[model samples]
Target: MQTEHSFTLVVAYVDDLLVTSSDSTVITILKTALNSAFTITDLGALKYFLGIEVSRSDFVQQLSQFLSEPRAPHWSAAVHVLRYLKGTINFGLFYPANSGLSLEAFSDADWGTCIDSTRSLTGYCVFMGNSLISWKTQK
Candidate 1:
């Protein structure tokens, strides 16, 4: 194919993954690589990531999503997440042992961002040294 594209591996849960980026061609290339190396499926495009809203950004070269918005992904969205996993089953999250052990947190919220329930949402992420330790978004 001929197009602009990029790809990123978001997360891996067991045999599943969440892959994303702005390039359709890169996605296609990733899918081809995955199919060659393992059992695979291509759930084109990312509409959801980690239960948050996900869609292409206006720049046409990136993806964006909120941190606290609740969502129920449709079939394709779920499949996209799954395909992401298939493409990156070997990836791992590593916090280097020699890295600092200090703990730090960052948090912010948007009041009444949810139009459906008129409730504010909370979003937070914690880090240990230079590694992300935890994160959450709730309403």
Candidate 2:
């Protein structure tokens, strides 16, 4: 409800309660009311949002360059990427079901940073609102 006096909105997302109000007192009052009804913990101020974790693409891309005559070091680097991915599996990209029609695109290039070919290792991701639609990395 929107009113000149005050308006508060509470959104529940996967065990998280997001509360926002036009008035600060309304926020406190709402929190107190919710806390009394159900046990809740207030985590203050958003800090670091864990985004994608990736080693430099050129380094990872290099490992696959010489496919016919791949050396031991190349194999080691490939294994490293696998290990890193496994370690950060819990923090992988999340695409929620509900999304809007906001198209967001991001692209990055290492600018001829490939160890062997010296070609640009480029990558891009497209998102519709908060949902990731397509992504790619190439040399």
Give the top-scoring candidate (TM-score).
Answer: 2
Worst-scoring 10-residue span by lDDT in model 2:
47-56
- Cα lDDT of model 1 by residue, 50-91, tens digit: 433465545212123422453555444656766998999998
Any idea what lDDT model 1 has?
0.68
- TM-score list, all predictions: 0.34, 0.39
Which candidate gets the maximum lDDT versus the true structure?
2
Candidate 1 has its poorest 10 consecutive residues by lDDT at 59-68
Q: In model 1, how large is the Cα lDDT of residue 77?
A: 60
RMSD per prediction, one decimal? 15.1, 19.2
TM-score of 2: 0.39
Model 1 spans with C-alpha error above 4 angstroms: 1-86, 115-117
